[model samples]
Target: MVVALVGNPNTGKSTLFNALCGARARTGNFPGVTVEKKVGRLKLPTLGPSRSGGGGAAEVIDLPGTYSLSPRSADEMVSVDVLLGDAYGTPRPDAVVCVVDASNLHRNLYLVSQVLELGLPVVVALNMGDVARARGTTIDAGVLSEKLGVPVIPTEAHRRRGLEELKTAIVAAASGPALQPVRSLPDAVVAEANALEGWLSEHGCPDVPAYLRERMVLDVGGQVVERYRTRCTGDLPAHLGEVRSRLAEAGCRVPAVEAAGRYAWAREVLDGAVETTPEPAATGSDRLDRILTHRVWGLLAFAALMFAVFQAIFSWAGPFMDAIGEGQGWLSGLVQSAMPPGAFRSLIIDGVIAGVGGVLVFLPQIVILFLAIAILEDCGYMARAAFLMDRLMSRLGLSGKSFVPLMSSFACAVPGVMATRVIENRRDRMVTILVAPLMSCSARLPVYLLLIGAFVPATAYLGGWVTLQGLVLFAMTSLGAVVAIPVAWLLRKTWFKGETPPFVMELPPYRWPSPRNVALRVYDRGKAFVTRAGTLIFAASVLIWAAGYFPGDHTELHAVQAKMENPQVAADMSAEAWDALEERRRKLSADLIADSALGRTGRFIEPAVKPLGWDWKIGVGALASFPAREVIIATLGTIYSLGGDVDETDDGLRDAMRRSEWPDGDPVYTLPVALSVMVFFALCAQCAATLMVIKRETNSWRWPIFTFVYMTGLAYVAALLTYQIGSRLF
Candidate 1:
């Protein structure tokens, strides 16, 4: 049996789904719409008093939360089509579980009423029962069930309360009476629906249900019609026009009629079933929102919160990150000590270990970022953040809905692009997708940390309250968000020109975040990061190691090692001679790298990147990073591993980079070069995963290709300007 879990946004539908299915759920996409589909197995109880283990697991699908079945967006339309069994790859659900917020019965019932109109047996899951009771609200489930002709189960999903009851209700509904439409349309509206059904059949439209026929005439230019438009035959627009004209002539307006009728029936159904005391003058959420949502104070609070988060990522994660680096170094030493000196040992230590470690060492920051975001989202401040950003987004011709996805890009761009399904306007969604990657992702964190630590002085600002390194790191991340604004404007004005959709969002009440939810979310994010590190970054690292390692000449390397190990020469040599010998070794290492294929390729691209103040070595690292921004660290690790003969734990790469000099004896990597590199990485579209997701979301390679070209061009220009100006100033 198949069942769908449906509800309005913020109704705790997801929480209920998780409670029901736990870890049995899997995620995919709906047939035609790109919206995510979550399905899980719900093992059903037996029918009678025994309620034994006789039944099989029911497949429960969690549809995207939507306000109504009128279908404003593609995602919302998905709920309608799936319920009607019109969506491919999904049959009509055996029963529908309509989860609603118990505290907001009147408003929530509006959607429940629409679900009832679909002619499917619905078991109402009155979620947030605890919150409702806390607010002095009482819901008579039996009364609600009698009034609505379905089971109403009061559920506290977070506590796993009423789940068994909810399951039982689902089983009862599936086996009970056949359902009928709850809200009947007016005679005139009914007549129009009947006439339109005939016209639709003649035009080769599918045999839509009576309620769906009513929605067809109601929601003008909605996703439902757009979804099936390909199969529609013989002047669909004319048939729709005639039906709408007759309805309007009979005094039933198109969109308003549907809303008015649904809401009227909802209010009637909710009348005596829900009883609420007068709200207090100042609720806890209201008191907090007064400051958090204030125009001036909210902005300050948001900035402070972001600053604290970035600071924590830098300061708190330092020890853990260092330990990872040291651990990798120790493992490399153990392998080096045990194995005979050969190419395989070198590959294991230098290629695999160094490359993978470079990526893994940044796991602390990624975990911290995911934890913070999960906290914000779970505690309900994320919605307020969007509400705060909406004001600024409107001026740029982007919807407020775009802010959430854009902010999500900071963790990873794949989900950020996926989050664009919430955006109702096609133009707004595409524009948001185009610019979201400009927000610095966790992948770029390693680059920022490496460069900022190497170049920026670790001095305290504001009398030790702020560290300069942390501030620079924060600035680099913020720069991405800043640069995205103008790029988004340009894209809005040209490629995706359209009127911005009005932003409507609900700021859910603040509550202590559930630790379980937060942990699960962080775990999922960490797993995804580790998976990419093992696959893409690992492959790139090995490839880079090969390019930097051979034509297999270790003559110069052995000579340098022999000289360094000679105690007799060390005793005879003065300090200056010792320094000179070290310099010679460094120069020989550089020369060896230049002889390798990777170095040759870097030299070929050197002139092109010279304007940005990059040497051939930095050019190679930058080019290798194209597959993933995180791969730059691995690439650099592999480069320094093969070239400098240094261990991973020695902080050797940064030191080598600092000591690097041109043939003219000028420094290769200065503060200006570091800053320019950071700027470029901040804006570049480097992650192949992000590009792949963009292509999938857009359903075309054109947008991803365009994204790469424009972002790379923009990054080059920005880096060039930064380097030129910084060179002059510094």
Candidate 2:
């Protein structure tokens, strides 16, 4: 059975899901939307065992967190659909555990009242019970249970509180009546809507709310017509349009009047059962937000905090990253020396070792990246960061919530795009997804690192505090964000027009995040990264190796260069060794690649990029790295002098690049060429994983194609512009 867990954003529903299901949770983007869905399964904990016992586990789908069923965003619509079965194929949940924030009972009860109207069996789990008790609030659970008609059990899931009561409630209600409509409808509006619905019955408006038909007509200027004859539920009455015309002819706006009798009932139900310490001037969330959410200091703190995260990634992860890189290089060498110089050997050393290993070098950053992000999310500061950035983002057709996904894109677009699930609005989520690629993803980092290491002088700047290299990298990131804003605004105006999603969110009281919970999220995300690299990067690596390995050319020009640059000087050399040496020399020539399929293709494309200063070899590297961006660095590392002196710091591949020449002895990696390459990667949509994610998010081939075409076109034009502009300036 598919069970969906739903509650307000900060109400600990997610934490409870993790606690119940452990690592079985699947985190992925919602079908046709960038918003993520996390679903998992676990055996009913307190149940003795299934009576029919075949190990059929009860599955729980942790739907995107939502406040109420008002359905402002598509994200929240998922919750409503799951709850009311209003949306197609979303089964009315077998039972809903309404998780109410114990401390904020009134607001929490609003959702409960609306949910109760859906006529589903619901067990109210009053969450954060511990917090309420500590704050001197008293909850009469028995009386509250009596008042709601349905069972009301208090729970502090984070601490495993009230599990027994909640379990018993669920177990008992599994086959019982789940929901009952309680809110008495407005007599006149309900009667009018029912008459209209009866007349419009031929269309697909079956079971649609009465008031919705009027609002739909006013907003869309269309009747409730079936989208397709195949989908028509029944025959329509003749006067369906007449009913809408009459409402229009009345020409007076009518605001919805609430059924206060139900509110009065819910209020009377809770009045005797719930009580909080009368307004302590400032309490947990308010006290904490005063500082952490302060307008200026919060912004300052956020900047400093992000700066520290980046500092840690670059500085602290260096030794580990270097170790991985060196180890990979060493393994490649060992394989090359041991194998009998053939396709298998080349595949292992060049394709697998060089390609996959190059991508893995950034693993340290990946782990640290997600770990820090998860920490911020756990501590609940990520939400605050969004709240702070909302004002600035609103101008660009985004919310402060856009900051989290965009910031997350720094590590990888897959997860960042997936994180958009947290944004409630469909339009907001799509905008986040469309523009997230512009956020300087980690795949682009390798390209940036390569360029900056080669071109930008690393030295004291700002009198010594900021290094030039660091500043340039930071500036580029800022530039990407600046460019993304206008693009987002344009998208909103053109294709994704919808109301801006509401930004109001509850800030949970700050508490030290649990290490156990943090570790689980980090593990899930890290494992996902590893699995992706092992497949995508590993395959790309072999492709890259093959590009540079085959079609040996025994040319005197490249043989001499190889001997001069990478001469094998073994004293125990024999005739066999000499033969091997000759083969290796032939393999190292530039034209050797041209003879191979990959090399020949690069040669064919060389003319297209020759104006940008890249030779056939560079073209080969570029072609090979298409499937995986970072492997371009590793591809170059292996392609250039067999991974020797590939420091990428001072004198980064620069010496070898400078030594390279065309027929006219022109220098490679000139200022114009480097800028061209940087600009190319800056706009290029070149990641197998990212493309897969886009396909998954849009659920169609059309959108990813659009993304690729526009981004590639943009990359070409941008690079061309940069090279031309720089040639004149430099």
lDDT (C-alpha) at residue 378 in model 1 = 72
Q: Which ten residues in a row have the lowest lDDT in candidate 1?
A: 641-650
Query: Could you estimate the TM-score for every candidate?
Result: 0.81, 0.82
Candidate 2 on 1-730: residue-level lDDT in tens? Answer: 4456777777778777777787888776555544456768766544433222322356677777766565545566566656756545445566677888887787777677767777767788888887777677889988887778888888877776777677677655554544556553344434556676654565554666643443333222222232212345543333445544564455422222333433555677778897877765465767778877899888988888877876676677788978997899789778755655556765787677766675576567667766787787777787888888999889888898887778767656666765665676667877888777777775677677778777767789678899977876786656556778788999999899866756887777766686767777878766656664346555655665665666564345333433433435544567787666654654464345556777788779988777666787777777766776665664565456435234344353666666777788777777777778877777777765565456656556676677778777777777778788887888
The list of candidate 2 runs beyond 4 A from truth reads 28-35, 45-57, 84-92, 204-266, 323-339, 352-363, 408-415, 441-478, 530-571, 574-589, 611-615, 628-630, 633-653, 662-669, 693-704
- How many residue pairs clash in each candidate at the backbone level? 0, 12
Q: Compose the digit string of candidate 1's lDDT tens values, residues 1-730.
A: 7889999887788778888887777765676555767788898886843222234568899998888888867777788889988789998888899999887888888888888878888899999887787778888999999999999999988788999999988888886666877764567777777777777777787587887777777878876566556677877766778878877887888878877877788888878988888874456888899999999999899878867776676677778988997999899978866765556777998789976785676567668767887788778897788788888889989866787677767766765776676575667888899999998887798788888878888899899999988888999989989988888888888877766777877777787777776776666556655663345556656776788767657676656656666678889889998887877766655666667777789989899999999988788878767656766665565555433433323377788778878889999898899999999999988876677667666756788899999999999999999999999999
Deviating ranges (above 4 Å) for candidate 1: 31-33, 48-54, 201-204, 208-212, 233-235, 278-282, 338-343, 354-363, 399-433, 440-479, 528-534, 546-597, 610-615, 627-679, 687-706, 720-730
What C-alpha lDDT, on a 0 to 100 scale, does residue 159 get in candidate 2? 78
Q: How many clashes in candidate 2?
A: 12
